[model samples]
Target: MKHVRLLILLSLAGPAAGAEGGPLVLTDLAGAYAPGSLPAGGGWLALECGPAGCALRSTRLQLSRKTVLHLDEFRVPLEIPRVKGSPLALLHGLALSPGPVTRWHGAGKDVDRVADQLRRRGRWTVPGDARQLALSWVRLPEQGGFRYHLGDGTTRQFLFATAFEGHYGGDTTPRVRWAGDLDGDGRADLLLSLPDDNCGFDDRLYLSSLAGPGQLVGLAARFAGRYPACGC
Candidate 1:
């Protein structure tokens, strides 16, 4: 068997524990955290967004005057910092308000009708041989160069490329970092990471409440980063 490390941030088949029992919780490290509020053990999922890339880490929270993450290999940050004043995070397991995160993969073949409807003859495919689709990224001409949709491949009205419209250049290669309800609104929100630069991805958050008319999601937040490679 090929040894598979979790090279992607927040692996699709992630651990399921406290995810299903409640609405999604996005913790703000800059704010006050109550006692016993966060998950114990290595149960927290954090996405590190830098100008060059983004990395997903599952860690245990250590509260103090500062916040420290307990990771393997004695890894840690020199100082506690916040992204854009409030770094919202997926605190625990993968469950959202309505259901679970989509375990999307690039293993399934594209439906010809869906591709033709979207009109992007790119590498269109479903998520791991399933009938339902999780994401759609179509190629564009002479501009930001891409349009993204999140759905089961029927309606492309939910365009979400605005998150990267003015933020990236030269083919903003987007990938869904995690996909599910983020704000308890019953519509699927998204955490996306893409290597528009040569190194890593710039992360973006889209929520259902922020969606425009006839849309399912809209840009709520952004985390810009870059790294040495195009992966977690």
Candidate 2:
């Protein structure tokens, strides 16, 4: 059987009133894999997003024999009986909510070079006129952590290190889904899946805004949470 790629966009149901006085709409729908194409004994991938732009929520999902995948931040995989011929139904289920399906753009060797430079020197250099950015995991270190970088042509700064602090194992770094002009500032913003320390496996959506001199500042209301281990 030939593997199929499923690409679906979630429609936004309009901004609802959130308790935090910010628009309550979903964001960061990422790491989606087609049911038929999943690896045997499917594993879980990170789902990161939250209500407010400042707050972050981390979660995971397992691809096993189950129906009605719960759309939340903390639900674990349940061993429900399999329902045959319903794989495509999962896409429709997600369509009930409103949000943009996670899409990555401008991810290529150039981005990899930026990541490599960041890993080695904690900085990257790009042409001064480039815009937009995307990233992908190139390799995992022997110590068990992910390796990737972010850049398109213009931006060459390491935003992940500045957002959180603490030593993340080589395999535990967050996944980069997309990067573009998210805040209408003409500068690229990042949508990252950041791992939460409490769960140690699940991840949260981190939206980092570009600041003066190519620095990244976490847009949290209070900046409270377990900081990422520094010295990556």
Candidate 3:
């Protein structure tokens, strides 16, 4: 393990080719195997088939390391292999201004690092600023995306959508939501609204564990928010 860490540090010299083709100082860490929950929520994570583990990293080089763990019965053989590699951000980090990305080296290094990078890349607004940020994967108006709105100087705008090119009306948007303490833990929980038939979709409520500023620990669907007629 020590040797692997050394190699990772050594590879931090020049920009390495990212999974998306961008040049970055990639790390050299192997997948971590264990039984854990999905960052998106719901049942235990099944990683025995793919890479031993998965990680979420922002464009600015911030990373959320994933660890697997088991729940329920111990009879289930959950073995995660190291093969899928690292996950790349679908969209660029939102920043406040233009400058070199900030490299956060604190306890929440990964999350902080990503936030700092977004701020540096002019991809984000003030942490608490009531600003609307749109993040997308692939080309705009052609893919899915997320929205972050600094709400009423008190709440933050949280929305996730499958369609990237359009916005939602009212709060029916599949993604407009918030992260609160659903379980009474200090950490925040995810609460998203599902779409309705008008949007050509069924509405529902989704929940997830917020690991950090923008990292989801695990995800699950709680209730049905929309019910449409069949064969519409």
Using lDDT, give the best candidate's number.
Answer: 1
Candidate ranking under lDDT, highest first, comes to 1, 2, 3
What is the Cα root-mean-square deviation between model 3 and the actual structure? 19.7
Q: What TM-score number comes out for model 2?
A: 0.30
Off by over 4 Å in 3: 1-161, 165-178, 196-215, 222-226, 229-232
The lowest-lDDT stretch of 10 consecutive residues in candidate 3 is 41-50
Name model 2 segments beyond 4 Å from true. 1-105, 108-111, 126-177, 194-216, 220-232
lDDT for each candidate structure? 0.42, 0.30, 0.27
- In angstroms, the error of model 2 at 157 is 12
Please write out the lDDT profile of model 2 over residues 59-164, one tens digit for every residue: 2233453223323222222222132221111111111123222322223354455455545554333232245344433444453444445555555444333222
- Prediction 3 global C-alpha lDDT: 0.27
| Residue-level error in angstroms, candidate 3, position 45 | 25
Query: Total backbone clashes of model 2?
Result: 16
- What is residue 139's positional error in candidate 3, in angstroms? 5.5
lDDT of 3 at 80: 27
User: TM-score: which candidate is best?
Assistant: 1
- Model 1 Cα lDDT, one tens digit per residue, 1-232: 1123333322321222123343233433443232233344455555444344333445465554333332322212222223332223544444223222333221113222433434345333443323354566665666545666666555455444532343434444454444544465555556554544434334456666777876656766553323211221
